[model samples]
Target: MSLASREALASARERLDALADNTAVDAAKLAEELAAVTALLDREVSLRRVLTDPAQSGEAKAELARRLLAGQVGEECVELVGGMVRSRWSRSRDLVDAIEELASGADLIAAERAGDLDDVEDEVFRFGRIVASNPELRAALADKVADRRAKAELVRELLGGRANPVTERLVLRLVTAPRGRSLDGGLNALSKLAADRRNRMVAEVTSAVPLSDQQKQRLGEALATLYGRRVHLNLDVDPEIIGGIQVRIGDEVINGTIADRLAEASRRMAG
Candidate 1:
């Protein structure tokens, strides 16, 4: 996203956080309404362009959004979308993208309110791993020719009773309507969004053995200190590493495994 879009998205997120803070606002319902708006904007390219037109007055665009959304969605959603149109977007599509993000954010807020956010985060990560290991499933979910309802059902079938409802709904939404993102990309985005709810980073930790509670806590604390942000560990045991652990946060990797050291030594000898 461009700088303008980033600024716009940040402003939109603040608005959403404010709404989420209100106990009276139904986050899930807000999520659905925002999603509907996203779909509408996505389909109406000319309208999206007009709304984001730099030449147009912000207040006018906002009024247009409010009039269009008044009875179609809740007041909260109307206000949110109106606020979005009042801001400058780098591109018309960025406006739609921002609305979609708010939809997901609302769902995360709902999970947080229900005290199921942690479970939802873990479930999202596990589901991503499952998809990574299963090519057939990944292909099916990413299949554009497949019916959206079928993909939704597949997600529910796999996640129902096994994961948090928020996780299930999130996965279903992504699988059914990926918005041109790869499955992996979509899942990673969702995971990051979930983590962002608590202002934390997710560390993919692979160790030679499963870490104990104390070990996990200590590691999380250390990473948090290093990064200056709280870190959530998504752990995996890989005995093949022989010893130590490997931590991945975004594109950065910290490799401490015996296997990595041996490989480095072998390369040095070969040189």
Candidate 2:
């Protein structure tokens, strides 16, 4: 996203957090409503263009959003979409993207309220890994020609009674309506959003073996101290690493694994 879209998204997130904090609001219902609105906007290019038109007054765009959504959606959703349309977007598509992200965030918040957020986050990550490791599963989910119903049923059969309801629903939505994203991309986005709910960054940590609870705690604390923010470790075990750990946070990687060290030493020797 460009700086403009990031700013707009941050502002929209703040409003979403405020809504989540409200005791009277039903976050799950709001999430569904927001998803519906996202679908509507995604399908209506002219409507999106008009709402995001810089020539139109923000108030006018917002009012139009409210009028269109008022009867079909709850007041909260109507107001939320109104507020989003009032913000400036880098492109009309960015507006739709922002709405989709907000809808996903709302669903995570609902899971958080139910004390199932951790489960949902882990489930999303695990599901991503599963899809990546299984070629047939990944192909089935990503197959554009397959029936949407079959894909949805495939999700249910795989995840039913095994994952949290929120996790299942989220994964299903992504697979059924990927819009132009790969399965891994969609899951990563959701995982990041879930981490944001706790104001934490996710560190993908790969080690030769599973870390003990104490080790995990110390590693998390050390990373948090280094980053000046809470860090959530998503551990992956790779025997190829030999020893030590490799940590990835976004584009930055801290490599301490024996494999990386050997490669570095080999390069130094050649130099």
Candidate 3:
């Protein structure tokens, strides 16, 4: 997204932040609204892609967006989408993220009110870092550097042992998310959203191999104790990590892997 578009999205996010107050929103009603917004954004994004493709003319794309959203979208949604189209923000990732924020904010509020949504939000952030840290894996997921099925397979073969059930499912879902824009864009939005759902942040831990069930339970308990609050640990597995564990929570990283130690040694020697 362009800088201008990013600024606009920031503006939109500020507008939506007001709804985050749990007291202001009706949990049940807002959940329904959130669902509606998600569906609307999905359809809008789909229409935007179909319309904005270089293969399709602008007029053709406009007409299509109109037809698809005209009856299906609510009055406010229609106006919001139409404004985006007019502003040429239909293809902007910033705007898409803005829409996602509005929807996710509503979900978070509803979940808070219901008191059932666990700390999945942190897990999502950790998942993003896991993907971003691995060049080959990140390329495969975000850039189609590998075949789709290969990407899916890599998730099973490499990540099977490393990540938690939720993390594994999240990766697979991102790899297979139906494309309106790039799958990465949609998946990234959703992942960040999952993080925003929790009260406490997520810490994603990577291991060379799968941790045993006993280890997982112990590790979770240990982490919760350390943080003085419950924390969700999403597991990630990569053979290249090469022994030990790498735990990442936001910008903080604890790399205990042999590979990392070697890299650190090399850096120190060079300096």
Candidate 1 lDDT tens digits, 35-93: 89988998999999999999999999999999898998999999999999999999999
Residue 195 displacement in candidate 1 (angstroms) = 1.0
* Candidate 1 global lDDT: 0.94
TM-score, candidate number 1: 0.98
> For model 1, which pairs clash?
none
Provide the global lDDT of candidate 2 against the true structure: 0.92
Candidate with best lDDT: 1
Q: Against the true structure, whose TM-score is highest?
A: 1
lDDT of 2 by residue, 153-267 (tens): 9999999999998998899889998999999999998999899899999999999999999999999999999999999888888999999999999889999999998999999
lDDT per residue as tens, model 3, 1-271? 7666666555554444544552654533443443454445565656545533556554665566566667665543444444444333435444545554555555555555555345334445555666677777666775544576877787787568765444455456457433444544555565546554554456778899999999888877877787776666778789998899998776788788999999999999999
> Of models 2 and 3, which has the larger lDDT?
2
TM-score of each: 0.98, 0.96, 0.46
Model 3 residue 18 distance off true place after TM-score fit, in angstroms: 1.7
CA displacement after TM-score superposition, residue 42 of candidate 2 (Å) = 0.9
Clashing pairs in 2: none
Better of 1 and 3 by TM-score: 1
